[model samples]
Target: QKEVEQDPGPLSVPEGAIVSLNCTYSNSAFQYFMWYRQYSRKGPELLMYTYSSGNKEDGRFTAQVDKSSKYISLFIRDSQPSDSATYLCAMSEASWGKLQFGAGTQVVVTP
Candidate 1:
């Protein structure tokens, strides 16, 4: 089984709408979950991160993890056109260099 899996969606949303993204993992050893946003032809930048199981919210972004279910999610509220980008879910098993990544989901926020 793949360690991590995410729907690579070209998810389209209107401006000011809420966007939801999710990922799942089969490995119970994963302790760190992270979400990253990348613009076309650019490097990914970290958006949110959670340690183990819990929910974290920052501004319009919320990151949630369910260790028992091996699932994670990211929610963006009041999304803007500038938020259009590729979102990637990644996890690590207590090793910084050994992160498992999912296929990035592309988001387009239309004005």
Candidate 2:
């Protein structure tokens, strides 16, 4: 299996829908889970970070990690057109920095 796998989705939905983006990894050594939001041609901005398996919430964004299953998810509540962007899931084994990222999922929130 690859270190990390994610579908590069062009998932389209209405503005008010709840959106979910996910990724799975093969490495058990990964200790950090992160979610990032990226606009076209721009670098991804970190959205959420979790040290281990659990849930972290910030505003309309929620990140969930399941270390036992090597699965991670990002949930966006009350989606808006502004939320339309590529969502990336990343992980790291380092205690300080450097992350390994998925290919990213593209989302379109139509008004």
Who wins the lDDT comparison? 1
Question: What does candidate 1's lDDT look like per residue over 22-96, in tens digits?
Answer: 999998999999999999999999999889999999999999999999999999999999999999999999857
Tens-digit lDDT track of model 2 for 17-97? 999999999989999988889999998998998998999999999999999999999999999999999998999997776
User: Candidate 1 regions off by >4 Å?
Assistant: 95-97
Cα error, candidate 1, residue 6 (Å): 0.7
lDDT of 1: 0.94
